[model samples]
Target: RAFARSEVWDLLESCHLRCNPLGDAGVAELARGRQRRFLRHLDIAHSDVTDDGLTELSKSDRFPGLQSLEVGYGYSVRSPNAGPAFGPDGIAALLTTEQWALKRLHVSVVSDTPLAGRFEELRSRFADRLTIQQIGTDPHR
Candidate 1:
């Protein structure tokens, strides 16, 4: 279930579902379609999506009217055995997208890692528009 169903998410406007270990294929396609037609707020925390899946979702400026994307501690899917892998630097893609009207991107992953570097780049491009971009490590931040 790599894709989201437009029909299911269609009925539920304000979707608040826990991230499944198998990934939320339930709304993958609906998440990809013209967002204005269905969604307004989406809260995804502790999902099984790594930078790979996030990058896939942001293939284009597809999600319009989406104001927030809360990915809290959800980027732990990378292979720890690997030398370095922090969510595939998908922030760059998200920040650069023309249609990402994101306001709250809550990622609890520590900063100054690979993800931070990508965030810096994204900040440069979208300094004014970007808000609540909480980067950097936090013992409980």
Candidate 2:
């Protein structure tokens, strides 16, 4: 809910936006030009964003300047086949030149159900540049 765009707000050179219950506000702000310039690194840890929200955000061309992105994880309400994954499908919209500037990404998720497939997709898209750290109680097939 803190999406204000002003010179005062622009002074934020380095910011680490983390929220356990990060809503659409940050996503909406990023979609806008609020954090367009000064925000080089962003951390959206502990955010409960679903595939739908991630898909919407990935489609945006605003984060071209982003150098690093860190996505945290929690429980999800994903389907069985897809198994609540947040892999390449979610990030597919960003794998192009629009997100080519990203030097690194750090994701911590419990990839069970279909989440593993999503994770695998991400590894494929990112090629050797991806490092995944999956921690879940479910077995991996």
Flag clash pairs in model 1.
4-27, 4-28, 4-29
Per-residue lDDT tens digits for candidate 1, residues 51-126, read: 6555655664555556666553423436543332235265555555556645445454534344446556565656
Q: Count the backbone clashes (under 3 Å) in each candidate.
A: 3, 4
Q: Which regions of candidate 1 fall more than 4 Å away from where they truly are?
A: 22-36, 60-62, 74-88, 101-104, 110-115, 120-141
lDDT tens per residue, model 2, 4-62: 34446465545566655665555655556555655566677557655555666666665
Lowest lDDT block of 10, candidate 1 = 79-88
